[model samples]
Structures are given as C-alpha cells and as structure tokens.
Target: MKIAILGTGAGGRCHAAKLLELGHEVIVGTRDPDATLARTAPDHMGTPPYRDWLAAHPGATVCTFADAAAAADLVINGISGDHALNALTAIKDQLAGKTLIDYAVPYVYQHDSAHKWPTPWGFMPLLDPVDSDSLAEQIQRALPETRVVKSFVTQEQETVVDPKSIGGGDHTMFVSGDDEAAKGRAAQLLREYGWTDIVDLGPLVTARGLEMYAHFHSAVGLALGRRFGVKIV
Candidate 1:
C-alpha cells in the first residue's frame, strides 16, 4: 500500500517506521523535510529520507499536503492535536474520495484547585466540552466526500510503538468510522503495526468516547508518575 504520514513527531515517526517494516511504500511529510533528514538518518536500510518521502517510496513521491492527499491510497494524520485541523484544512480539496485515518485529541489543561498547583494540573477533555459537534465530526462535515476513520487516540505514543511495556499480550485498539470499508482498512494498518486485538466501536460518533478515554489515560499517567497504557482483557 502507498501510505503518506504527515508530521514527523514521535507519533509520525513510529507510524513511518512500522510501515516501512511491513514492506509498504511510506512517505513522510514534514514542514522542514530537509532539516528533519539532516537530523535523523533513515533507520531502515532501504528506506530513504525526503523532504518528500513519496519520491523514495517509488510509484509515489511526496509533494505538498494537497499532493500527498491526492496521490496516496491512504493518508494518516499523525500531526499533533493542536495542528490536526489546520493541517488538514490546508489540503481539504485533495481529500475527496480518500480514506483519512485521524488520530487526534483536543485536550485543554486547566489548574486543578485540589492539586494547588501554579500551572494547570488537570486536562479538560474537549470531547464533550467542545460544543455538540466534536473535532472528528467537524472534519467529517468539512470533507463529506472523504471517508474518515478515527482511531489510536486513546493510547500514548510509546504504547502504540512498543506494546510489550503495557502487557503486550493482547493490546486493544478502538476504531470508529461511518464507512465500514474505511474502518476495515485502518484496522489492517493497525495489525501491520502489530496490534492484534482491535475493537470496532462503530460510527464516527464513537470518537467522542475514545477521546474522553484519552483524557482519563493522561490523568492517570500524571498521577502515577509513569507513562500509562491500556490492554484488552
């Protein structure tokens, strides 16, 4: 499969690394592709670094956000939560008819009176706080023609990359989307990343629940002084 992953942070890098391992042609899109390459060498022997990873992937080469969306069989939005909407808005035109795998959490932090901390100690999950229409719903509305599947937001970056640390035996992933085919495709990619146990929560509306789950995960991690993760029983 020809895959394009936007953003080069830990989440993006992890997805790119796993995709490369699975023998899928992967394109990594970043704002400063050249600087990114200069900083980190390609971990995979055959993989190539690119301001435009599409070119190295062969049959597909990286261009602008619009180009990547238009050319790719699958487009993974691995950008940070704050930048997800803006990044996708930049290439909205090319997203029609494409399958978009959205992994984002809108979490705003506020000081917790109970903690008596100067800075915000608790996160305000935007899942319910952000009006009736959630972030995923907004994206779906913006690109009606595109099939959007939401997944991988409940867990931290580390857990997704190395499940073993969090009782890797049968880690679970929750996926929700309006399109069954799109959700199925996303599940296939999850399996490629070595996620064997997946829960299809059904429809894009279920994303709200998953986002709240992420907030809980974050809160628990903060309280425990550790990087918390989840697994399915």
Candidate 2:
C-alpha cells in the first residue's frame, strides 16, 4: 500500500516509521520534507534518507500536502487536532474517495492554573474543551466523500509503537467509522503493529466517545506518576 503521512512531528514520524517497517510504501508529506527527513533519519531504524528511502522503496514518494494526498492509496492524518481541519481543507479536493485514517485529539491549550497534582511521569494527551463536536466527525462532515476511520487516538506514541513498555499485555484499540471496509483495513494495520485487542465501536459518531477517552486518560496520567495505558483485561 502506498501511504501518505502528513505532519513531520513525533506522531507523523512514528506512524511513518512503523508503516515503512511493515513493508508498505510510505510517503511523508510535510512543509520541509528534506529537512524533516534529515533530522529524523538517524533515529529511525531501517529507514533510509528521504530521497534514498523513496528510491529504495518502490512507489514511495514524498511531496507537498496536495500532491501527497493526490497520489496516495491511503492518507494518514497525523497532524495535531488544532490544525487538522485546516490542513485537510486545503487539500480537500485531492482527498476525494480516499481512505483517510484520522488520529487527532482536539486539545485546547490553556494554562493549568490549578496545576493538578499527581501528573503522570510520562507524556499524556492534552485535550481541548469547548469543542462540542469531535474532530473526526467534523472532518467527515466536511468531506463526505472520503472514508474516515478513527483510531490510534487513545494512546501515546510510545504505547502505539511499542506496547511492551506499557506492560507487554494485550492493548485495546478502538476503530470507529461510517465505512466498514475502511475500519477493517485500519484494524488490520493495528494488528500488524502488535495490537492484540481491538474494538470496532460502531459508526463515526462513536469517535466522540473515543476522543473523550483521551481526556480521562490524561487526567488519570496526571493523577498517577506513570502513563500506564488502559487495557480491557
């Protein structure tokens, strides 16, 4: 599969690396692909330079957001939730009829005046309040033609990539989308990444609940000293 991953941040790099390791062709779309690749190359295991990476991997190519989405069989949105809508809207036309896997958390940035104690030792999801609608639902509403599957939003990057650190147990992942086939494809990808526990929580509307899970998870992480992931045991 030719996958285009947007954003050059940790989330994007992590997803791109995993996809590349899985033997799928990957194209990383970013504002500065060359620079981003150079910075991230060393840390990525078995990942070649962006130019060399593209050459070594058949059908893999990186370009700006528009071209990337236009050329990919699958486009994964790894951008922050705050910028996701705008970024997709810019390339909305190119994304028609595409299977888009959205991993976004609408996190409203505000100073924690209360300075909640007992914060987790590791990273936690910072959720945005006041947005009554979930990011996935909003994107689907905006682009009805595109098949959107919501997954990979509940856990941190490390947990998604290497589940063992979180206890090496069966970790659960939620998939919610209006399209069954798209959800199935996403679930397969999750399984390949070593996620043994997966739940198809029904239609896209369920994304709202999944997004809320991030908030609760964050609070718990803050309460505890560790980022112990949630698992349905």
Q: Write the per-residue lDDT of candidate 1 for residues 1-233, one digit (tens) a residue.
A: 88888776667766776677678787666655557656435533233454344334344344456666776799988766666777787788888888999887765443333533231543353443354556787788878888999988877655675566666536688899999999999888877666778899988988878766765676677788776556666
TM per candidate comes to 0.77, 0.80
C-alpha local distance difference test of each model: 0.71, 0.77
Identify the leading candidate in terms of TM-score.
Answer: 2
Model 2, C-alpha of 78: deviation from truth (Å): 0.7
For every candidate in turn, the CA RMSD to the true structure comes to 5.7, 4.7
What alpha-carbon RMSD in Å does predicted model 2 have with respect to the real structure?
A: 4.7
In model 1, pairs of residues that clash are: 54-60, 54-61, 54-62, 55-61
Error of 1 at 69 (Å): 1.9
